[model samples]
Target: MTRILLALLLILGFAAPAAAAGDQGWWNKDWSYRKQVTIDSSPSGINATGVIGRTVVLVRLHSGNFTFTDAMPNGADIRFVDTDNKTPLPFHIEHYDSTVGIATAWVAVPNLNGGEKHSIWLYFGAKTAPVAQDEKGTYDPDYMAVYHFGEGPGTASNDSTANANIAKSAPPGVDDAGIIGRAARFPGQGEVQIAESASLAMPAAAPFSFTAWVKPAQLAGTQAIFARGGLTIGLNAGVLFVSGPGVSLQGKAPVKQGDWNAIAFTTDGKEGHLYVNGLEQATGPAALGAIAGPATLGGAAGQPFTGELDEVRLSKTARPAAMIQAMADAEGKGGKLVTVTETAEKQSSGGGVFFFVLSKLEGVDEIVVGVCLILTAISAFVMYNRFAYFAKCTKGNAAFMRQFRRMDGELVPSAEIPGLDKKEARLIKTSPLAHIYDVGIEEFNRRKARLGNRPLSSQAIESMRAAASEVVVHENHKLDQWMVILTIAISGGPFIGLLGTVMGVMNTFGGVAMAGDVNVNAIAPGIAAALLATISGLFCAIPSLFGYNYLNSQVIPLASDMGIFIDQLLARIAETQAEEAADNAMGGFGDDDMAMMEMDDSF
Candidate 1:
């Protein structure tokens, strides 16, 4: 029994690792750092290196003076894919703040996991939209404006988006060691300013979003990260402060100086929301008015930003919570990864019910189910065998009883029965009723021999009854063989299943502890796997229980038949002896009787 269980568990062990691996193929993952693809405003097609196992690629473009408008720049055609595969990989634009004469562009090239080095073709010209989708068809963000100040020792930084809004520096500018790419640094007096445009201004009632990645050198009186017309996102006294017309709200939490923090502010015409590091820190009711002035970064209204600011984004629409977190997640801040695979979602949404859940079962669960299957097979075999054997015994007993009833209490040799084939004779020899008849006949014959043809004594009749009853006991024992196996199946199946379920739960908690992930995704699979065990246990037990009840019902009647036949045989023997004794006491008178008396006739 132990060995069979071990074999079942072994078969189950392989299932989980394989299923886990198969699940991986449904998603885009293993996002290791790949080669950087370089971009420039000029049409000279440059080459970039690539690596293996990285499905997502980051492209850094260094265009010194040109501005990236909402549309792609003219004479720029940046085309790339795996050279061997020869398909255009999906791409998205990531935004960063600008510095003088030195701007940066971030493009994500996804699904490039092939190991072979691929040739990338690049030329600046008419281009398609930077929007791209994961395998699930969810679109990656396409920023309207992106400025990355990565150019070393340059006077003017370029705008990355097609919208031509470049920043010009007043004095000493770029800082090389930035939080991400190089950042534009400002002294108390220097400022980087973009000329006024309709894109730079926000509507009075329209939804708006603003986000910035900043590392503050000083958090004293007030320092503006970005200030435009009426809206300003700044730091004062170690706390983020957002101020607009009739709206002045400070973040509930404080941040330490020199640490990178993501701060955001969003307003949807009726309410304003503030965030620190991807978490909403404050909210208030409001309607923000439009801003008329040009946008200023690093320093605004004479209060200059002292430290590094890397990525800053301003959109005309308020972003959802998931998108807000995605922005932070893209830059390696606190947020969940957006899954590329839609397989799990598709399975759940399609509504196949229980079979779908069964497919998702874990290793221990599969093992428990297998054991239950074995038990079920054994139970079915036992029930079928018992039913067939009992039916045969019942038919044979009926046939023998029919022949015995027709005999009219006449004792005859077995060979004298008419038309009996060898097969029929063999069946009678093995039948329970026939065995009882043979036992009674043998006992009577032995007593008759001992008493010398006299009427049998009362003590001898009692002894024959005891001998016949003993044969019935032996037949009852034969009927009970292998019934205990059915009992074990009924009782033991559920307990084994419970053990598997408990082990599965333990494994689930252990995995959660090791990974430090306690979300629904982490918890659900384990719990589902655990419950499969109980399902299997019930599968094994229910059929066995029913089968045992049915078979036992048949056995009881056969036992009763044996007892009834024994009693009738003993009574007939007693009655025959009494009649013979009465006749002898009366004295014989007829000739045939006188001849029979001389020959010593007996019962």
Candidate 2:
């Protein structure tokens, strides 16, 4: 015991290096420096040289610039060295940013740290240049960090920008990202600080402000970042908190996903401001008392952020948009390049609003709908006209039969426009009175030969005389072509109307289902469909049915009359034939020569 006590006393007396020496700074990060750095330069950048650390080293600077502007790189940074390969690191590199005119890049440093030093490089998109370049040689890569922002591909959020219900958990298309849903996100990953709540707590809430370079995936969550009953960002339901209360002065400044935006939400408990890329997107009206909520890194109480968020920052004072962008720019420096996925797109944070705005796009959708309607209407009109045309043709045919039957001229031309055989036409040309003959002259000759001038006064003459007793046959066939359209009118009109009604009813039912209740709103659409279709059907059918019967009635009587007229003409001609024969015989008829000749024809 005495030996132990003596040893303890000696050790206490000797004193030891402060055990908490390495745990005092920010993140107590792996770094080498005496105390801390204090940087303040005008129109010039700040840097930290002689500082040592393992592997990846970060040089943070707070600039008053906006989105990486209002400042330039100066000579205060430590020079990286490739102690092994005797080569530079900036040999193969690229840089990126979204400034007006800035461009910077980096190369690989295969010499130092197994090429860790020159893996990536970055800079502002414009005006960002390498710290220095060897005029005689390529960039040295001894001091480079692998940049991994905007390196991947971009994606699309919507195909036509008109989807009201965008799909979630889908492949984000190029140049677009995010979808519409409740708390929807994309490429989702993060650790839960606290399961029930964002179960993480800030060690000290003394002076805390939050900022992140992000591209929102969606604007559908009730809250983007909500803790307890307080702090929340994003389009929280219909509310937004730049950096203050959960519900203060709500504005309508929404952010689009898939684009690079440096957002900062800083509060001094009294005044809070929301900055985007070094400019204010909006301002908070609620004076924050203490951000009395547990610190949330990337999402609501329990939901992880669903989009790409880079360069997370938390400070005691509010960061200007410019400063945040500078941090991003600095990250894009020669090494350890920081980047936002200008190419990557998360889900949208505002799908409904976006579409709502788009729906209001002037004359776009309306014009499309109008064109569709015009096409439909034209189709309907053509169908209706066709139906009417069928009736008109049928009626006109009947009228032609009546007019022809009443004429005194011989019924030489039949309504059945006979297909003329060239041979028949030639034979008709040989017969002078071809107009009066239904049969070709060859046919007439053939018939006469069978009788052979033998006896016009015999049974053959009786046969002809019997037929002349009637004109119209009253036994016609082959008359159905013009009836089809009328039949269609009778049957199709009602069904077409019914179809419209059915579709309208279906629409109404759908509306009811969507609204979760049956009401007048739901019923109106169905009724409209029903009424319109029914009306259209009636429009099609009525005339068709009427014209069908009218044409048939007019045609039947006229056709019968035409048959009677033909019968009367045949009978009269036969009687006159006998008389003419008698007269000729009385005038100069004899027995031998003339009689023989006459006999030949008569037989």
Candidate 3:
């Protein structure tokens, strides 16, 4: 038992390191692929077999060893780090559904020649810290609304936030030459509006921030870029101004025409500040409560600004200088920003198995696994004991048979047989040949004593034959001992495991009902744990089944050998009796004389 425990511990110790190594290799890895698509231009637009142009394409990308729910990954989620040199194709990811492991990207294949093949190499995942969208490596939730203006013709521009405040353009058009893929383009006569909604209305005298990228083609008389009720911020003759009721704040520096510029403004009931290209240009006192009303971009009636605007963002909180600077750097052409499709936790980092197993396994699952472990131990012990016993029996039978064959016509006593020591007797106890020979020798000696020098009768020979047959049956029974344990293990292991799995699945659904959640996180653990029980059952049964089959094969041959030995022993006895009977018949001794002779020999 102590040795068994030590052997189990050794197995565990060796397995732990191997499992750890496998976990690392399984989790901390990346996948990559490369492809070339030939382009064919048409009058409508350039066409490719797959998503070749700057259109959004779904892609199924893998990073580690596990399967992700999302089958289709986005082309935008993948950046073409290396590609055939023609013109650098600009690509950006629009959305990445990490749950499904799918992403959407818009690839700009404008410069890619039609009817020409473009080679691309796509690399997935990274080992280093992920790049953040902002320098602080955090995304601010204070942004109540963010509009990239990446809408198609006649579609409303969506606000990328928890608050879905969509803006509708009057003419409904998308400009491709914006900071991102597309931006809302407002002609002089057109305007984009989001009627008086609670999401757009800033709380009275509350801190607020507004940022936009604007390029004015012509800065004539006062042209309003943004207006909310009487509060209006616009460019008036090459100068930016923020006006609310009777109070107005003006920028110190003048603005230029036909150039893209980042403009930002913030107010906290006390002061109003304006920033141009991330630099604070002016500051002024703000009214207690600026009038709030319907917000409009581009002049509604007479004063419409003639330019392109892109990337409009509005936040409810007054952002710190660091955050503003970070935003500027990130949105600017050159900035230290990390762009990833998913969060850091969702990325592959080689640490999932432990949590995955723990989270999924219920109380019943643990119990089932424990039961399986016990079954495995029992199965192992049974197989080892039975295998050893069979091997020993086989060896002893060979040795006893070899000695028996060498013996002459006269059977030797057990004590006189070569190599038949006390130790050999203990081992040969399970040997059918040894058992049969011992029975035959004892019976022959008893019959010979009764008949003295006269040969034994047919009845004495039949009695010896019956004794040998009985010994053969007993020896066969000994060979088949403890085999039922193997049968139990092989038959019961899988069913027990299945019961545990069924219970686990039932519990998983019950948990879902109780928690009111049906997501993968809520259910994957329980399902995986339940499945583990079935795997454990197989683990217990497979070896036992194999061992039982092999032992049965060995036992059948040994039983056959035992039957043959019994037959041979009976034949030898019958032949010896026939010779003796012939001698006695030829001598023709009287019954009284025979009786006196037997008595004298016995004395």
What are the lDDT scores of the predictions, listed in order?
0.59, 0.36, 0.60
RMSD in Å for all candidates? 16.9, 27.1, 18.0
Model 3 has an lDDT value of 0.60
* Candidate 2 lDDT score relative to the true structure: 0.36
Error of 2 at 419 (Å): 29
| lDDT per residue (tens digit) for residues 1-603 in model 1 | 432443333333332321222222122221111112322112221111222122232333321112223124431233333333244454433333322112222333443322222334222223453434222211233333555565565566556555656776532567665645567676665667777775566667777777777888787878887787867788887688888774677898676688778788887877888888767788997588766677787778866778777666666667555345444543432112311111122211232224334544456667777778788778888898889878878877877776776766446544456667787776676578888888887787677667644676778877887898899898888788778877887898888889888987877666544332344544565666677687667767888899999998999999998888888877766666566556766654788878787788653
TM-score for all models, in order of appearance:
0.48, 0.30, 0.43
Candidate 2 local lDDT, residue 297: 36
> TM-score winner among the candidates?
1
- Candidate 1 residues lying further than 4 Å off, grouped into runs, are 1-251, 254-277, 280-324, 327-358, 409-419, 512-525, 576-603
Would you list the rank order by TM-score, best first?
1, 3, 2
Model 3, 339-423: lDDT tens digits are 2221112333323343444334555777776776677788788788878888888888887877777765667655568657787
* Model 2 lDDT per residue over 40-89, tens place: 11223322222112222223221101113222433212122233212333
